[model samples]
Target: MSYMNLIKEKDYLKILIAGVINRFGDSIDAIAMTWLVYSVSQNASLTALNFGINFVPTVLIQPFAGAYVEKLNHKKILVFMDLLRGVVVFLIALLTYFQCIEGWMIIVATFLLSTAEAFRMPANNALTPVIVKKENFNEAISLQSSMFRLSELIGTGVAGIIIGLCGVHVAIAIDALSFFFSGSIILMVKAKSYLRIEHQNKIFTDFKKGIKYLFHTKCLMRICLIGTIVNALLVPINSLETVLCIEVYHMGAELLSLMGIFSTIGSIVGAFIYPYLAKRYTERQFIVSFLLTMSLFYFICILNKVFLNLIFLFYIHLIISYFSLGAGAAVLSTYSSVNLLDKVDESFLARVSAVCVSLCTAAVPLCSFLVSFLSTFINVSDVFIVIAILSLLLAVLYSIISKKRWLE
Candidate 1:
């Protein structure tokens, strides 16, 4: 029999396309929402709060959501979440276009969107391995990630232009439409979801089991910790990028758009090169070395003083840096599960992935607030230096810890 018969290729392709369409909305919203909040309130704290609200539901609800995703039909759960998000986003788009949207309304929309995402994310992660053959799984995930980056590049670049020409409301409306389109695509996909056993054990028991699995497994736990710290350092730099480009460097949306493009180009390059690198380096060595290199690159980008020249240098640096980052991340994601896929079961997969993503998501808001507040007191360049140093330090610490624990 053909290998194609082993998995639902058509359904997988639909899921990937749906992800791209949905993320176009996500890309626009990332810039538009922050700009909208900052425009209205003219306060850093309020903007930070918007980020905080976006993450709160995922942080609070993810453990339970993980357990819930395992027990349900993953495809149906994905569809329902997308539908809920589409409706919420469409309403926000309407309210925004009418100039009726308020700060609180924006925050509420973020909360709802994140809550839906909290449900959808774990289901999608679990569903992937179910639908794709084990041998092709890495390629599937890499393609998905590269597509996501492409969506980010296109969506954010377009958002910059649209926000400049038509304003934030139009961008928000487009994002809302994108979500609706994504939901429709999800509805078109068909897949066989594995049935979960009726474990009479408590829900917390399932949650704890996932946690215990993570903790007892040295490689997974260390990766999570390293990932969390790396994110903690990285998110603040991103939060400050817009402010740095516009306010400090006297650049505009055009340059910001260029940065997105170059960064994405780097990711595409990285994804393609990853398999080759996998053959050349051990996973741990590759991860730690790349993390350290990216940290240094970020530092150099900030230290370059010439505005236009800095952008050019940053363009090159980001491409290389992101390629490294993507390569490293793929290694970690693959290694997150060491054993045969069948033993961990779907619910366990959901729980572990949820917790990991939740922690990473939670870090962004906290770090954003820290970055914003720090910018008010110190130079943004100084903030970048601090972040770069922290990233380097974390990479070193992670290496030592991994070695001592025999995590490899």
Candidate 2:
């Protein structure tokens, strides 16, 4: 399907606009949040732990959030979640501006923001199929992914300038306005769903049903488990990114912002090319290709970190390695999401997405803690290399399983 078809679907286009606006705010918040955590707590381990905390509520709440969202109006859920997140961010901005913000306050703010997201994500995922044609799923997903990355690119660039001049509070306050804008725009969308199921059972029972359904599906639980570990291993690379930039290199927020800029550049390239790549490659071929590519880059990141000798080499390695890593990650996420959507029934999408999202979210905090814990016994750099190798081993395991036809 041509991207033009997607454009003509005005409802989906509205949703895309909402997504772009929302993610634009999120990109700004990401920078603010990262620096805020580190600024409040100077310890690298604590900073990583707090960074991971943003996703912790998703793991705990989304399974129930999924089951609950199954019976509700998805559009309203989107609006509510947007509003709720805006309020939380606005409060954070206010506290920061007042010079009354503490480390614990930042943690609470992140927790509340993600709590809204726990409910918001499942509803949005469930709502999408109703807005767009199933035939154009990959194309739409790719376009959405590309736009998201592009918005991040622009948002981070702008955020750096904002944070440098105005302050983190201003950047966060701007993000708050974006949420309000996105929520209002979504109210203009005319999407409705027939998938609001009436459940006789309690939410816990519905949660079990979602899990039971996964157990019955081929490689479903297995896939989520593997994804959890791989995601966990991959997270420390990002979770401790602040430490890497600040302590290791003596560079600060500029380098941190540059990292996001480079990543989004790679993500844009990857997202635009993914639909074509999906058509050209088998599922096994696609998975193996990205996994192997990611492993290669992880190795390169290690060499660049250890063999830090030249300023030119440092920037060169950062650009090339992160760009390639970012591209691999974007392609894998797009393919995996579309593949999961294809396998799931429309009615079960919210719950299943919640479960899948839960595991994926669960990985980050667990491993972020692991990174901190391991830092006590080994050098932080060593912890990174160990996790990178573990992630690579997942690729090897999947390659073997895929060859044996365990997965399509």
Candidate 3:
């Protein structure tokens, strides 16, 4: 189906709008939160800790949240999450405005916000299959990815201006309002029963079933393992980009926001192209190729020292690396979403998605901690190089293993 037709579908359209608005808010929140933590603590470790805090709940709470997602109404879950997150962000803004916000408070807020997301994501994922026709799933997913990236691009592009003009508190306040808007939009989505499980099992029983299904499915298992390793290594690099921009590059908020916008531009392009690409390549082939290419770009980025004098050259290299990685990530995410829908029974979908999200993000906090700790002992650039090398090795290993038709 064409993009126009996809948007014409009322339920899908509502979900897309809500997702885009929420992501835009999140992009702004990311900049605001990172800057807020760094400004307060003046410690790179603390900054990294702030980023890692968002994922901690995903790792710890999502597995059980997934089972509950199956039991609850997806629409209600989405609405409640938005309302709860809105209140939390608004409270943070109030604290910031009062000059009472501290690094620990930011961490606490992040943990709470992510807790809401932990429940929201699985329900949202499970709801997609309910709204979109099976034949148009790829197109719908791709469009959703693109919309999300577009929002990121816009939010990041404007975030620096907002911060420079108003303040971090203002950006956060805007984010809080965006959540209300998202919640309101989601309310208009008219969908029937989102839960497919007629008789809900015990939460632990459901969690066990999700875990069993994940392990039993070799293709999904392989994808999850590779994704987890890659995320662990890459997340720290992303978490520290503000440090690199401000401390290492001697740039400011505007430059950091510019970098974010450029990176998201690549992601948007990648997401836009994914539907067509999905039609041509097998999931395994697409994933393998994207990973290898992304790894190569990452390696090339580490060679920035060779052209240190030419700032333009460095920018070009960074943009290319970001674009390649963003595109690869979009493709992989699209594939994974579609694959899960095809493989898991509808009753088990939310729990399975939650488990997968949890596993994929399980190592992020440790990696973030390591990055902050290791940067004190080793050069930050050297730490990134280590991650790049690991990524390359994983890409090659995945290529070799993907020779089996597990996805088939």
Q: Give the TM-score of each candidate.
A: 0.87, 0.93, 0.93
Stretch of 10 with least lDDT, candidate 2: 221-230
Give candidate 2's whole-model lDDT: 0.81
- What TM-score quantifies how close candidate 2 is to the native fold? 0.93
Question: For residues 224-305, could you state the per-residue lDDT of candidate 2 as single tens digits?
Answer: 7546644765677677777777766677677778888888889998888988887787766666666676666666766776
Count clashing residue pairs per candidate.
0, 0, 0
- Indicate the TM-score of model 3: 0.93
TM-score of 1: 0.87
Model 1 error, position 18 (Å): 0.7
Rate residue 146 of model 1 by lDDT. Answer: 69
lDDT of 1 at 200: 47
lDDT of 1 by residue, 1-408 (tens): 133443457888888898899888887877777777766776655665577667778778887788777888787888788878878877877887788888899888888999999999888888878777766755666566667878877887787888889878877877777777887887786677645666746668878887787677665556566566556655654565666665556666665566566665556555545555656778568667756865875675575555356566756655565555545544444444332243455557888877767765677777766766776678767777887787788678867876764665
